[model samples]
Target: MMAPATTSRPTSATAPSTFTSSCTRRTDGVTMCAWRDSGTRIVPTSSTSTRCRNPATPTRRTSRSVNSATRRSSRRGSPPRSIPCVRCRIRNRRKSPPGRSARTRSRCRRVLSARRCACGIDRIRSWLTRTRCCFMRRCWRSCSLVLIAFVLAACPTKTEGGGGDGSFEVQDPLTRRLMDPDATTDERIDRVLAEAKPGNTAALPALLRVMRHRSQAAFLVVSDGKARFGYRTVELRETQKDTRSMERVAAIVALEAINSPVALPDLVLALDDVNEVVQNHAARALVRLGNRAGIPTLIANLDNRILQRETANRLLEEISGKQGFIADAGWAERQKGLAAWQEWWAGIQASDERLPIEGRAYQIGADAEADRRIGFFVDVVGQYQFLFHEQARKALIRIGEPALPFLREGVERARKDDNATTRAGIAQILETIDHPNGRELLRDLLTDASGSVRARAAEAFGNLAGKGAIAALQGVLGDRDPGVPIAALDGLGRIGGADALAVIRRYVPGEDSALQEAHILATFAASRGREQRDRTLAMLLGVSIATRNAAHAVLVRITGDDAGYDSLATESARKEAMERYRGLLGG
Candidate 1:
């Protein structure tokens, strides 16, 4: 009956025995197919079971069933050698849609673009390999190093190329010219210097080069050091119109080269030389030297009918110590003191819009009740007072007689019941005026109530030092106030002459620990030398005067000496630079 299910199934399973075992009957009367391989069984029971075998004849199937059962028993004893595939209902229905994943697409696009870019780069690399300049890299590196070095050098430092020290050194172009053997330049320079009144335009460059010894001083006079030097010597000697002119230019080179007071007399004579060129150069040289040697001569030259007032003014501006080096030197050098005093007085009078005494009285009354009222008004007056004092002192020696009367009146009035304000102003004004009353007033004000007034009085007394000022100034030396004593010390320092050393030594004491040491250092040669000079210069640089006072000092000190004190004028400029740098750094 089941006659044979074999009736429907193949006897030898022509369908290629996918099932490895024969059919078998279960206890429930259900038939099953099974297969066996390597002692493992594949049995199909439910429709959900996995099929890895084929079914054949019952005999073979029966054998497979027995073997499959045995394998199953063994499989139960041992673990599976390979994992079975898992079937997930969710995976079957889920579609990936039309596009590949974003990551895969991006990767593919990148690979394509990279391949193209690489191909292009390969072409460029090949071209460069064949045709690029061989020395390009070397040249680039060398130029870069040179540029870096230039940038570093241009940045200022404390080394040899730093600060103003390089200002005095030879430049590259000048160096080249000096090294040249050609006589054309020498001849050309000779003819230029030989001109009767050499226009500064053509002569300045050649002169500067020659002066620095960067170019040959061929247009200069024949001298002991340069007679056999070279074509420069010949050209210079040949260019001289006369011995006088030669001597004048020669003196300039010597002054510039030597920087000595001994050259003063010769320079003074040249200031009055009949030749205009000689006079101009000599005056210029004296101004350049920046010592008292040429100051009297320069002042005396002011009387020249032919010299323009503008020229005189220019010369005055040039020679006056706008920064008060002469002040640092003290007014004892009468010529320097007078020059500075006159310059200071002139500046004060020119800028003063108010009646000097009346204005201070009104200003003091106005500020009398406010918190900082006194200081505010004092500062306002002090600005003009200090500025003018500085300028007047530098140029007054040149002004001489013109400044006396004003100086006398202020000094005379300041001595009696002078309020601190009035006394200070009067003393300051008198400081520039060399008249008798001016000296007397300043001397008397030395005993005033206020420290500032006394300071002003002491400074004025120093400025007024004549035979008359000695006793009064020395008396001021014994004042009770420390600043008063310091001021008196400064005055004595500037007024040095016969009573100078005794007074200087009286309070000056040992050069080592005195307050006057700064003032004393540059006024005259102390027992100490360079050390004194350096300390004095440091004091000048470090002393923190008010802004206008500092500006006035810088302007006056380098006046005339720097062609116009341009280098020295930069004291204020440096302050401005600091401010701007601070802003940039967000400080």
Candidate 2:
């Protein structure tokens, strides 16, 4: 048929005879050829044969088919192989034109498949090697975006209230609320006072800040038609009087509540406040804190015209064991009392022996000799270190009656040397002893030149609670020093006799509030039975509100009847209430 279709094969001697070429006639009337190796399998190959001119006629092997053939060839022990078709490989390198038909696309896929089989492992290896850098670049870009988002979330945003130099800001919420204009005066005062409870130390700094704060308004008119001064901005007016009072009161209450020696400095500063109540509270808080540093201020305030004068005098007497120099003296006579106090202060300062031992001059130990301990007690008492005074008193007390003789000798020696501190310490010890001789010794000190010495002596007499020194105590009732009279009244209360009652009654009608308070206390002690209470109730009529209030409190304690008295009520209301009580007592 057609002259037996002459065939052509590879002429090389290395080409095996088992390898064969197939030819297929296409509809276009052209022939195409494919080659198969006996050892490998069917593989596409470019041919120069004249009968194989139509490229489409030869069936191009797909990658799937090539892989199958490769697996079969490996099992048959064929060597590594590839399709020998250079033209097909060059065709795979060109991109297909746009808008190719489905059949054309199918043809392209087949060509690509055949090209993959021809290239085999070498094509895959080249692709991976070429794309390594680009793959890493794409992965890095994705990771960078995710990292940027995380960093933004972790950082804090800047705020207007943040510290300018990158320090942590201090914020007090209660203080901010207090400053709010919407807050009522009563609400603010109540909140500030609530912070004054014991153990609320965290509020201490804020309370101190509040104390130092000045209102931004100026020229406040108080409710009682008085002019009160303040600092205020031009925009602010009419600051509440109660608001300022509450702030000051809160500060004093906080100092007292904390009751710490560390608050002593602030309490001292508060003594200089313009408010008389603040100064009074500060002095009292200082005494409660057991800080003698406030003693000077209290002494200075004894001459103050404010209501705090009596309070300051009382605190000074309590702290220094000294009589207030001027109890009922006029302004001119008070100058002499102040001079006497200065003279005593100067005398103690000039005495080298009165100086307290500092550093290692004294050390207390359980193993120390009795003589050494006694010396330490003496030094501690003489020293101005009020903190150690209580401890020293305890040591002497522990020494018991055996130490009384030594203390008595010390008192005599101190008086000769004009050592007021030592004499005061001796007087305190003798008061604790309450011996018959101790009472007599205290009576002698009651007339000592130093007002402090006389005050301590009077205190000792009151503690003794015996009628032995009542005459000596009564003699000082007319003494110029305020503390002496007060102490005498207190001593007479403890002793309790007709003469003491008569002296206390004399002060009940007096105008001095301090003396009146002392008189009420003394009478309360001297009144022994129901008859005394009824008699004292009769005497309380028509007194000042302060005196009547004191008498009402005493009557309530003794008789368990408040007598319809209300301290906070108006003057007329209180008077009417007192009149009702008097009628009940048949006065």
Candidate 3:
């Protein structure tokens, strides 16, 4: 019959009879035969990849049939085995014409670039070539599967905000530093705070991690160092400043700086942080955010230790605008109040109504309308975003003396609150109120028992009372709190008189802490036309960089020139700059 069509198929001796080189309109989606392996070609295949290729010219015995051996072997009931799948079309890849699918193009990249995939494919080929067809039909399949399992297991998984408990990337370097044990990094924290804009929630995950973390670095500590997990007396460094208990406090500060509603849930939940200091910070953040969700937690803390009870009542007063809760009352005294606080919180919750609260740091008063305006502005001033705090301060000043009674009341109430930032914010409103009503109250606040309150009030008095408040500020010069004296100096310097300068000159450098001395020296620059401006110049030569920092910053702001004065520079360099500035100054 036409010489039996002169069959062109190769005999078994010439090539493996089971090779599948099918080229019959392959829908494997690959088109070009770019890469080739001689003898037995093995290519790795995965769900996302195909490492095998078909020959360009249809080399199934040159054309009598494609994949002739595979079909033949299958019909003979040879249990199917994975050979180099020649019909698995090789991607045209670089040769692929325009309009090739994105999927095909991407697959082309993965096959060529992924070294592991290429190696795995090469290995599969090696295994197939080493084994006879009979052996490949059985154990080779198992071996290939094990190898693939190993390759896939080595790859890391990609994720996006998955459950929010895993690692994530943030643009700020402070993410790790803020969350880690050595979180005393204020320069990094200030950088992050400067960017804690309304829309920038990138650092929110890291901030939350810090709030939720209660684990402090456990190492040896000196006897007097503050310890959260109780103290164990061990001989450590003699000059250790403070302990690691301040770690979470840094995070709470950053979160408040973020001033975003997105952090509300995390801030509320952080109220239960094992460290009461952290708890107090979280409570203040929630109040400034204007959400009463954490009120129950603070109220629950009322039944806790006296410290927690005092903190709870303090935060509760801010939220509810009521101040009847006595902070130092024993548990027996506060137990009844605890039940009342819980009931009050529950009732507000059930009604789905906003609590009649003043703010995180201020309070409402008998005058509801004025209380509303003051609270509204008070909340705005605490939000640092978009210069909203500055704008709100201007608004409160415009409200004038009529708002003073409530504003003064808010500042007094702010004393018991632990959020110094919020306390300072409320104090700033009083400082610039321009209303004469709060002047005496501002003077009175300078002598309050709380150091922070006294410090805040002292700074406020300079703006509210000016030269008139000098006697009050002088009384505060010998105050026990290191910051109080500095605050008093700042106030007196703002007033700038012979009397104020005389008080400023009384600073005996060794008598106060370095920071206090630094601050006092900085105040001298604020007191212009005084001969003591040279005192600020002298402070620039101090050993403590913090002391120099305060002095340098004030000089720069006042003179509008640094004179190459770098507070962070070497001691000799600082002295040089100080000399240069002295040359710039008269005497």
The whole-model C-alpha lDDT of candidate 2 against the native structure comes to 0.55
In order of appearance, the predictions have TM-scores of 0.26, 0.31, 0.36
Ranking by TM-score: 3, 2, 1
Candidate 2 collision pairs? 216-232, 216-233, 217-232, 324-483, 327-482
lDDT string for model 2 (1-587, tens) is 01112222332346532344455534332235555555566654445231222111223443676556644553443322433233333333243344664335334433343344545667544543443334344665788888998998788743111112221222556655544446676776677777877767666656654553442212111112131111111111233343465566666777577664434434555655666556666766755644333445655766777456666665555544667655566887777766666665566546722322111112223223333335435545665556455545545654445556656666766767678998888788888775676777777788888888888888788777665677777778877777778778877776776876776776532576576566666776665332345445544554555656656755665456787777667667766776776665556
For each candidate, what is the lDDT?
A: 0.41, 0.55, 0.54
Flag regions of model 3 displaced more than 4 Å. Answer: 1-371, 383-386, 412-422, 433-436, 447-453, 464-468, 478-481, 496-498, 501-516, 519-535, 538-549, 552-585
Q: Which of the numbered candidates is closest to the native, going by highest TM-score?
A: 3
Which regions of candidate 2 deviate over 4 angstroms? 1-369, 416-421, 502-513, 529-587
The candidate, 1 or 2, that scores higher on lDDT is 2
